[model samples]
Target: MKVMIRKDSKGTLSAYVPKKDLEEPIVSIARPQMWGGLVTLANGWRLELPEMAADTALPITVEARRVAGGED
Candidate 1:
């Protein structure tokens, strides 16, 4: 298994090793986006995903980690 040692802002030792990454990298996907069926407002445009419409929103946070390999 691979281990990725890192330190947090609180100054603590930590190791991060994703379950998928442990078995080496696998197939990656990159989809293309088309500008069709897009709505344009006074300032910006938006796309609606009626299929994925939800009554509430979820909180999201971004976390950065330094890996030993190349940039991801």
Candidate 2:
């Protein structure tokens, strides 16, 4: 699925799923830089993000795979 990753004014990370019309704050990340690893959302959805540069800009949409804890 396509997920948009961004940081709010307060610098909180979040993921938005366009198809589902859902947006949730990212609660935890498997990798410190938050790429090529899994991110856990506040709603309990786990998404596997693609590999990207450490300095990749935010509010960017990227392809990610849903790994666990969400409805199809």
Which candidate comes out best when scored by TM-score?
Answer: 2
User: Could you give candidate 2's per-residue lDDT for residues 26-70 as a string of tens digits?
Assistant: 999998879999999998899999999999999999999999665
What TM-score, computed on C-alpha atoms, does each candidate reach? 0.25, 0.93
What 10-residue stretch in candidate 2 is worst by lDDT? 63-72
User: How far does residue 12 in candidate 1 sit from its true spot (Å)?
Assistant: 0.9
Segments in model 2 whose C-alpha atoms lie over 4 Å from true places: 69-72
Q: Can you give the lDDT of residue 72 in candidate 2?
A: 50
Full-model lDDT for every candidate: 0.26, 0.93
Residue 14, candidate 2: how far off, in angstroms? 0.5
- The lDDT leader among the candidates is 2
TM-score of 1: 0.25
How much is the lDDT of residue 58 in candidate 1? 25
